[model samples]
Target: MNSITHYLHNELPRINAFLEAQTARLDPVVRPAAEHVLGAGGKRLRPLLALVAARALGCTADPYPMACSLELLHSATLLHDDILDAAVMRRGRAATHVEFGRTGTILAGDVLLALANRLVADYDIPRLNAVLSEAILRTVTGEVMEIANVRNTAMSEERYYEIITGKTAYLFQGACECGAILAGCGAATERAAHDYGLNLGIAFQLVDDALDYVSPSEITGKPSGGDLREGKMTLPLILYLRTLPPDARQKLETRIAQDDLDAEAARAIADRVAASGCAEATRDAARGYATLAAQALEAFPASPERDLMADMLDLVLSRNK
Candidate 1:
């Protein structure tokens, strides 16, 4: 594995240990489902970020509890998200809701969320609870907004930004902020880390949306056109729809709303979006956010940890999976 991957691998074990320790105390009925979903390996990006941010701020103590807390919160959100999206697959396996049934998955998610709160309860850090509580609320609001706009056929770019920022970026911001809080960093440094994560999260989601249109099934671990089938509005489609002739746009809208798009139609739409420069535009926008993320690290002292954080921003920009 590369350096970042190696670092993540080392850190994740500690995070997982804490998670297991916490989950072990949960009700027996829900514990199995929670473990099943948690054991399904993920990138563990949020927890990793917590560790990275803490290290960048010169923290040398164990970050495991904070990391575990962030992961549990993230896992909880994913469980709920899978149900909301009716997502059938997660991490190359059946989604928790599909595997355990919706009610079971919901309870498991709730259990994980409660575990996260328990992990943070003893932290004794200023603003920690306030930040976490707000992050949770914002994440739910973002999901609700996205659901409300699904299949609307007229969702605006502004609305899309609002949804993604709230749903995805807030948690990332919280993770980084939690790291800074644990490190006892100054408010400015804490805010900078939060900004870095927020921008990185937005960029990450944009790349995910782009890949949903272009990546193969094996690479994405999900079927191509799944987003289209769900009537979800993404950046590429929204930008392309704006540039199409009125009649073509209308037809495309009807097809998308009805989820009637075939592979050929999906490809045609992707090609048109690429040809119209919207894909490039979307990529440029992601790059801009990545740039901001990198800039957010300027206040930190020069160190390997800081450089790795910057490199992570680049990785986010270029990642295909």
Candidate 2:
């Protein structure tokens, strides 16, 4: 196996064990649902990023507790986001809100958020606290803005970038920055790590949006064209809107505005998008961001850790689900 793959092979089980152990300490009211959600597997990518970042920066101290906070925070967001999206499946299983009532799911998310905070606080690092706080604020703001802008055909690319950066990039920045801080790295190194993570996050989300049009429920663990039905215009769809003739584009916008979407309508549009090369265009955009993500590591010296980050950029751009 390559460096990154080999590393994950060894560390994934240990990381999962750590997370499963923490589930027992959650608030009693939300514990069962929270455990169920947590048990459903994910790549745990955010925490994995933090851990690799710490090692890349030559961290001597144990960074697992601090790094794992990102996973907890990310899971909490999944619980809350599923409610807002009315999503049925997450990580190939029922969403927390489906298994537990909405209130219970929301409370479980809150408990996870509190637990994440406590994990960071135990390290006694002011920068870590501030990073986590800012990530939370920005992520919530982005989600609120997304809700406000649903089915907006006229939404500008700049505005879309801003929302996605807030929602996705900030949390990634926090994770990498926390890793750097825990490693006792200097300011310049921390900034490099921050920039790498921001670009990586943008690339990750771009690919995810592209796959929504093309990937099926079996492969992706979520319904294909879920965003189309929800009337969310991601980068792929937005890029497609720019190519259509005026009348055709207007008709599509009108259809997207329909109060009740049927399966046929959603499927037709998704198929059109897939055939139109919009998904490939979106992947191209992700490649640009991935290039920036890799470039951010140019200043760091060569090491197995550094090499793995380069491999990670490729992995992020290539991910289908």
Candidate 3:
């Protein structure tokens, strides 16, 4: 089994080139903002997922164009998310909103989304178009629900899963499903690919939430405790609250409810959650999902690509950013 790093090194360049060329076509005013984010380095995981799934299903032709569409879609979502989160940083640089103003940045994001639709439509595949559309709707619905439930300290673990699945997992599911569709895989194989992506995405989000509490801003490319500062109850904070005594839990909840949880308070809570071992527990939960993601890969026959898919669990579980 080749490591994801290996596949990434071999596969990401084509996706990157495709993204660069496509982004270059934006309106003159929109081009710079779009380029800024497109040029900013990311793991390119979604596109890589698409490429890997296609290869695992025995496709020989280049999948870069199709895979890059997923990257564009993911980038569009991030642009909107930064505005909603009031995020100042992304990919270790100022967020698009910070650089281009909210309106311009939002317009740039819309352009990327429109390009994604255009690219997908270029294939003239109805199933592919339908999958991407459903995924976009799910992502928007998840974001809206997340905002509506801000500071919901009593939000259940089940409900939290629903939010993350819609926002994060569904796109991953779409990426893998897209790969399968592109490769002309059988129905069962496509379902397996989707299952793999869904579980991997859930684990990825859990780890990301844990990273928000424990990783330095330099490492994560965003401030630690941003979720807490924004009043979003992620898995670590949720698990930590469960272990708290009544008085402590109430105090913590009150602090999170503030419109502005200052840096000092946010750092303190982040530290407390880290110290309470909830961070570790959150990682453990992620590991469980990673296992499920790996299990879903068992339906595929043995091959380097399938092995790479199986190995993705380790990559997702251990990633720092």
Candidate 4:
């Protein structure tokens, strides 16, 4: 396994233990649903970021609770998002809503959110609760905004950035900030870590959008053209639409506006977007964000932890490429 995967494998058991111990005290009905969602596999990127950021701040304290809190918050968001998007699959299996039913999934997600805040409240770290609370609110708002923009062909680049920053980057920023807070780091260090995670998160999402256009269904664990099928306006399609001649743009828009998207037509549009260099443009933007993320770490003293964080930024781009 790669470094991140290896870290997760080693640390997640401890985090899971912590979660189990805490949730054991909760109401019986809520426990099973929370456990089910928690046990559902994920990349655990937010939690890993929390742990790494703590380490980067020169702390040796166990980051298990903090990491677990981050993971809980992330998982809650995923549950809610899958329900809102009507996403059928998650981690190559039925989504939480698909398997548990919509109301059950919503309840599960709410439980996770409450559990995450409860975990945060247990931490003795000053201001951590306020930061995490704000982050969660922002993330929810971002999701709502994105959902509102869905299928709106007139979505602009600026609006897309706003949605992505809120939906993804804020949680990452909160993870790093919480890490630094727990580690008793100074404000400057906390801000640096926040910037690092924020930029990395943006880059990660950009690459994810790119992957939707290019990666095989098996590798991506979703059908190819999933974004197009859902009529979600992503970076590549947005850029591609701008580059097209007037008539060509009209035809593409008409196809996209259809309720039942034709797979062949979607594939053809993806091919045209690829041929038009929009994917490359989107990639360039991702690289720029990766560079910014690396630059955010310059304040920290040179160490393996710092290097790993920088490597993670590169990994974000490399994964989708």
Ranking by TM-score: 2, 3, 1, 4
User: Which is superior by lDDT, 2 or 3?
Assistant: 3
Kindly give the stretch of ten consecutive residues in candidate 1 with the minimal lDDT sum: 266-275
Name the 10 consecutive residues with the lowest summed lDDT in model 4.
1-10
Task: Estimate, for each residue in 129-242, the C-alpha lDDT of model 1 and write its tens digit.
Answer: 788888889999999999999988888889999999988888888888888888888889998988988999899888888877777668878877677778889898898888
What ranking of all candidate models by lDDT puts the best one first? 3, 2, 1, 4
What lDDT is reached at residue 232 by model 2?
84
Please tell me which model should have the higher lDDT, number 3 or number 4.
3
Q: Regarding lDDT, does 1 or 4 come out ahead? A: 1
For model 2, give the 10-residue run with minimal summed lDDT.
256-265
Candidate lDDT (C-alpha), each: 0.83, 0.86, 0.87, 0.81
lDDT of 2 by residue, 140-226 (tens): 898888888888878888888888887888888888888888988899999999999899989988888899998887999998889
Clashing pairs in 2: none
TM-score of each predicted structure versus truth: 0.94, 0.97, 0.97, 0.92
Highest lDDT among the candidates is held by which one?
A: 3
Task: Return the lDDT, model 1, position 35.
Answer: 86
Count of clashing residue pairs in every prediction: 0, 0, 0, 0
List runs of model 1 lying over 4 Å from the truth.
262-277
Model 1 clashes, total count:
0
Looking at model 3, residue 161 earns an lDDT score of 89
